[model samples]
Target: MRIRLQPLAASIAVAFAIPAVAQTPLRTLDEVVVEATRERDLPGAAAPTAGELERLRAATSDTASLLREQPGVSLYGAGGVSSLPVIHGLADDRLRIRLDGMDLIASCPNHMNPPLSYVDPSNLKSIKVYAGITPVSVGGDSIGGSIVAETRGPDFAQPGQGLLTKGEVGTYYRSNGDQRGINLSATVASENLSLSYSGALAKADNYKAGGEFKNFTATGRGNELARNEVGSSAYDTRNHTLGFALRGGNHLVELKLGYQDLPYQLYANQRMDMLDNEQKRANLRWLGQFDWGRAEARVYHEAVDHYMNFGMDKQLVYGTAVNGMPMYSRGRTTGVETKAEIDLADSSLLRLGALYQHYTLRDWWPPSGTGGMSPGTFENIADGSRDRAGLFGEWEKRFSPQWTTQLGLRYERVTTDAGDVHGYGNAMGNQLVDAAAFNAREHKKTDNNWDLTALARYAPSQAIDVEFGFAHKTRSPNLYERYTWSTWAMAAVMNNTVGDGNGYVGDPDLKAEKANTLSATFDWHAADRRWELKATPFYTRVTDYIDAVRLTNNAGFNVLRYTNQTARLFGLDLSGRMPLGNTALGQFAARGLVNYTNGKNLDTGDDLYNIMPLNTRLSLTHELGGWNNAVEMVAARAKNKVSDARNEVRTPGYALFNLRTSYTWRNIRVDAGVENLFDKLYYQPTGGTYTGQGTTMGINSIAPGIGVPGMGRTFYAGLNVRF
Candidate 1:
């Protein structure tokens, strides 16, 4: 019998760009290999193929938005382009994000430009997400698992063949926000050399909400009323990359240079917005294969300069003078990594690697008219630096045809230091207790951390497989978590990853966080590979988890201090797919996924901030000659268990429907979709507080407390052509 696999809406839209490859015959679970990691499959791992990535990119310009549908994944809204991904309730620096071969760091204090923002989705070739219990060889200094994104690699012509050229162009538009974007890429290749260039531009107006209207009272404008326009939610961005590659007998080397410019991006969850942002990056890599082993090495550098201020939407309420103060931050990262895979005894392999990184950061605010101190700068972090070095080894062995096992270990040394930091005092230039105490203490610290991983896979029958994994992971505190010296209102608000509108002061004496995770996966598949079902359950305990403690409750703001606490997290992920026999009308299929996670501060007996609520997605798909369509339903449970420390609010449960269809004609393809079909008004459980200053009359105002509102009904369409 021939097995037929159905493609979902996201994957079907890209079928025209690149035809899908034939699937290989099913093999025993012990023989399954993950192409991205070059290792056996791990529990709760998802890797989208190239075609699926292309289709997903056509729908949204934000890189993080692509992961929203994946199991065990949720998004923390910040700016239009800076949505942060959360896995099992861990976010931001708590997770290791690998872009291409480089470990990129967030440059902004507000984390405006995360690692994923560096690479546009239009240029991505593949993405792999390890939800929990990640392999030691692939990640370090993180407990939330790892995300790896790679751009299209060089493609060379066959030997004795002539020069080859390829190019693609695409454009998309969305109705709700009047958003528009364009992407272009071109490549030229010879037998020995290849060159490529890609670029993208995206812009959007403020998105509209889904409710009624209210007049503005803060601005004292009786004529002005907010019907549904979400305040401070507009953005404009551009990215460009140039790459070159050379191939020799058994070795290949590649070089890539990238530049990004974001002129303006409003943040709904922060007090300020990104005004000017720019980044420059360069990466050099070498890959070689020999009879004995395979070797890979990479060196990369990144420089970022960011500026933040008030946006036009917020100025209407606070006035331009009061919110005109501009904040500046600069960051630089230089890193190198080398790894080798060696052939050991039969059915066994060994892998070794080493990595080093040097990072520096500076955040300061120049004198401004509306500021407390004029003609003097407030240095949030001065000459802050962190250096890390790690070494790791892994061994994989097959004990028998039915069983496979792997073990890995890693050691990392981290050192961090910062120069004397200063804060803006009251008009008298007298320091507050938080700043005085922090400046009087030592500024240097070091940590020696270790990680361990053990995993095994057992296949008792062709249709049944079981996998178990255990991991011990460690992460040193980030510079912001250790070096922010001020307890002032503005300084206290900078130490945040959940976008909660609160102030925080860092504690330089905090210890590194360590985590232990245990996870298991069960997979059941048909003999012909037509359908599959997978279930995963995981538990984690963290010692010295970095959290916030309320220090003082001011009239308008609450001051928080960073502290360490014990935390626990438990979660389950379930996914399945089945094919309905083909009929004369078309081929039909059904697929669904459900995810649930609970996180708590074991020491404080409080719910963790920004924990995603239970959610599920179900879809029905239809395919015919050159046409594919899908209808999907998404549902989420209400979030009532709020975090008192962060003053988080509860959100009501909601359900939404979406419809998508795509058609392919030769080298040209068209995709169209309608999201939030019923125009339901809801809020995402993970979306943090609304910090945009606006009239208190509207439901989504800066005052009276409001969560980030979801976008209203939206219709989008796109076209792509390849030659």
Candidate 2:
């Protein structure tokens, strides 16, 4: 099946959203092995069977990497387990990311623990991507769309079948970073009760680039980093989850517990590293089916303990703390959600929902010893709190089989506040003056944000479909963006989230961002859906966009403060797939896609930072018996339209190829692949500045104009067995 979502007229098909989707029998994917599977559901990956998840897990441990194949989606390179996702031209806090009905925020100022990083790829059951326009029921408190991720759902044995049991074990290795990992899951069920558990562990050392990217071999510490090595790129992580479910005549109840422990995840673009991070989560949900329709209610909570400082590659500086410039962050989140769906007369449907989330965070650097690090603890963000309460409604009706339309509205009340903060010293580094100025200001803020979506879809014939939509969304600033009070270079530099090798201060009076977008999609396909083509183009204008301005006169990595401005973004996505016919030995197919985006600051007249350049991918796939294979080509154009404000780096165009093969038997499977097959070297356009080593605390300490390099050629293989 070819499921291509449109760009315009958000008919959300969130006019057709997952929250309101019925749980019918989906594809089993048991007959073939695909490198990755596209969801049959429009606009999202709401459903994926075990077979699909297994195939995706065989090659990578990074969960964000799984979505790279999706159109209109890009990534910001970060730690091994954490990568920020970009939809259209917005990223990070600009979009909504949900895990098991819960909205998780990054606790670390450096954004080392993005929401997706908490769930290991091996443990994911399904992930949905709502690319551009979105309906009120599917999203709130965000300007862009949404990505919803969930674990395996509950399962029950048939009556009179006694107890049922099943499990899977898998392992994989990648030669480039010496990466290795193991995963296991077990489940037991009865007619009315089910219990399951899943766990994964992965670790790796620094990886090398295809070719030398620098001249220095020293890390400015007692460490050695070869010219071809990407320093601060190593990581060790483990994750575990347990779930229980109970079902009765017309209702189902479920409880889930999740935990993650990442001892360390070095960063190639930032000075600080995640030395230790721990997350604990619990969620409870209930679903009931009634004559009127369906109803759902859920409550979830999450707590985090995070620590950061210099890693092995970066020179350790400052304080009496054992790990150098020790930073600590503790956060807690609690939320409640409820929704109801009503089936109206004449194929009309109405959805109404309400949600509330409360969050608290404390970020501080304990006094270590000497210089500015002595006297007192540095309070980056003290007693910070952000709360949101939202309500949404949607109306959808299939006027006929060939015509469908949807409309939605959402409103959110966001409030934020913080306690007084202080620096380490009274005079050193202007700690006294800056701290006094910040402490005297009132820190409370509130915003009443609104969102609206209008969409329509038409299927003129079996071979043609058209969809278009318009959306207006709003988002308030996060704690790190509005309450991180500091102007001292050393203190501000440690608070960066964009990894640009710059210091960043926060503004308390920043306004919420509002965006208006226009979009449309045209799809053409064969009657049987074996061959398909899709084109999507979109444009968005934003008011009070959160940009930044220089706070200091220092050149290259100076202090900057968060501010508001006007901006515009436009983009296109093209994709097509067709059967190449069958032969005596195998069946062949072709698939290709292209993505292009341009963003500008209307106020500053400068290009937006980290906008992905034009890129394309093409692949030839073949299948025979239980064997499946593909040869892929990936290329990107030169990134010369730079962001002068951020002093973004420029890179030349480049191309690389890859080979993949997989074989599946009754209960066993094996996968092998070689990436960057020819060992081509390249820099990541969105990977941000390189501050992976040396004495990185001082402004302009690291060399300028360097971007994080892509990984070198790698050989990877995996094996999985199910019983």
Candidate 3:
């Protein structure tokens, strides 16, 4: 398949040919929104709004991919839609993710679906990332930091206006995998009430690599001739949401409902593929403002039914006799949170909040002829449940015109348990050694977690600002890490987070992880704010860090057991932007960023698994009447230090280039881009192992030690209409 670039070029030419017209001045692209409270110099914080967000949304459909350029942020690929975000070397459950103030958890043991996957990029209005040493009031049960994604909210008509209606439609296409998508949103509003609806559909075929194949370990049979294509990397998805809101005086109420359907998705880092996925969610919120303070409350519920099995591509070589494993999982969560802010004095304010959550899960598999197992049902985790209650307080003080400080603390009580679990041997009236050993253990646990944060900011002059932060955070293990109840390879693999193509068993006696971190940020800006530079450095130490331990080699698969260890991480992030004086043709700007992180196991003296290599990005942007254009370069250092315990492989470093342009005319917008402009062949340091069927390039063909290949050169275009 080939994409014609002539038409895209013609479109750009036509946009430039239009006669110039008088228009309002456009906002400079270098301005950034500071989402943190009164103090704008908070360490390790970023909020990309307006034009920056629109440009990012046009680049990819995966929500997590949008964070790749943020300081200390990286992505761990799972499926086409499920790219997990990592902050400062920690990922998955270690980070707190909230969408529109609602906390969501992944139902799949493989983490095929995460909180960010629930919101399409087209629906997002803004995103805020809080890096290491996050504020206590903004984080809970997490150590890495927090991410908040807010969707488009209701808009009301002006007073004295009777009614208002508006809508938008958008479509995009990518040639790399023949990917295509469409989004629709509409709204109706009156003086006091509003209604809104949103819908999206997206699909893609397997993507191809930039070069020819090379056989590696675990690349599978008959895959040696895969050429440039990465098999089984496809997906189909659809989503819908409805919202309503009412306002009276200083009080407002809102409600929202959402639904998602994912019929099929392939996981290149997993042994099984997602055959079906369905989810539903509902949320309600209330906000009130009084002379002395403000109060807000929210309630939400989420549920998912997911299934996984062998794909046709894999069965062709492995066959039903050796493969054909099927599994099912169901998860439901309900929660409520309320917070209030009070005016204590002219220079001080106090914030308090309380939260409660209840969660339940079940995972199971049914015996079938394909595997030649006894006829029965095996319960991986049955009636697993977790409940949590928390309370927090925070205070912010402005000491003087040049100084500000904040302090916060939080406490949480968590309890977990599960009903008796059974394996196929029990259903077949036989005592399997693995099943008997697991069934004999207790399944109830409790934890008391606490969090603390302190930060201060000072602006010595208009051109210089300095900030410092410190935090102590705690997190308990998830249900899968405590209640998997089996030592079998198939059941154990479901509890893994690193996606290293290995099976894993859970440890019921695991302990909570506690992290202590200190970070600092320095900012320098021109008097007019046209040029700016920022740098942040951080260090963290973790007690009882969750890690994996090798168990046994069964059949052709390696199995691991979950355990706890001491760990440490340190990193630095630097960014800068500058604008050149405007010329007759247009305005120009330059921006760049560099990020690096190091992580190690304190007790074992080994490197952390899948740590990202040092990377940097630079871009030059130009703007004319109504058009914007940019050229970007991305480069990374070679990753030679690998984790021997996980059988990780080292990858050579490479550089790639990309081009993008956009134009707006009246109520219509057009965007076009070409990625991998140089067609460089490279590997993603954090793409996990190749579990897809067939043989490909790598060191270990039977189990492949090489990382997944990066996508080849591709062209993309998008159109949006709004009124």
Pick the lDDT winner. Answer: 2
Indicate whether candidate 2 or candidate 3 has the larger lDDT: 2
User: What is the Å distance of residue 334 in model 1 from its true position?
Assistant: 0.1
- TM-score against truth, every candidate: 0.91, 0.94, 0.90
The residue ranges of model 2 lying beyond 4 angstroms of the native Cα positions read 1-53, 318-323, 553-555
RMSD of each: 5.5, 4.4, 8.1
Give the per-residue lDDT of model 1 (tens digit) for 1-723.
Answer: 001111111121110011111121111111111121222122222333333445567678888887776767788887877799888788888888888778888877778889988777777765656775677777799988777767767878887879979888999999988989999999899988999999999999878766632333232332332656667788999999998999888788899999999899988777777898999999999888789778889999999999987676654333444435678999999999999878675767787999999999998887664546454677888999999999999877677766777788999999999888666545432345655677788999999999998887777776766778889999999888888766655455655556777777788999999999998777776755467777778899999999888877543347688899999999888777778879999999887889899999999999988888999999898989988888999999999877788788688999999999888788888889988999988887888886655542122234634777888899999888889
lDDT of 2 by residue, 515-611 (tens): 9988877767776557777777899999999999888765577788999999999989887778898999899998887889999999999999889
RMSD of model 1 against the true structure: 5.5
Candidate 2, poorest ten consecutive residues by summed lDDT: 25-34
Q: List lDDT for all candidates, in order.
A: 0.75, 0.82, 0.75
**Lowest-lDDT window of 10 residues in candidate 3?**
13-22
- Give the distance in Å from residue 73's predicted Cα in candidate 3 to where it truly belongs: 0.6
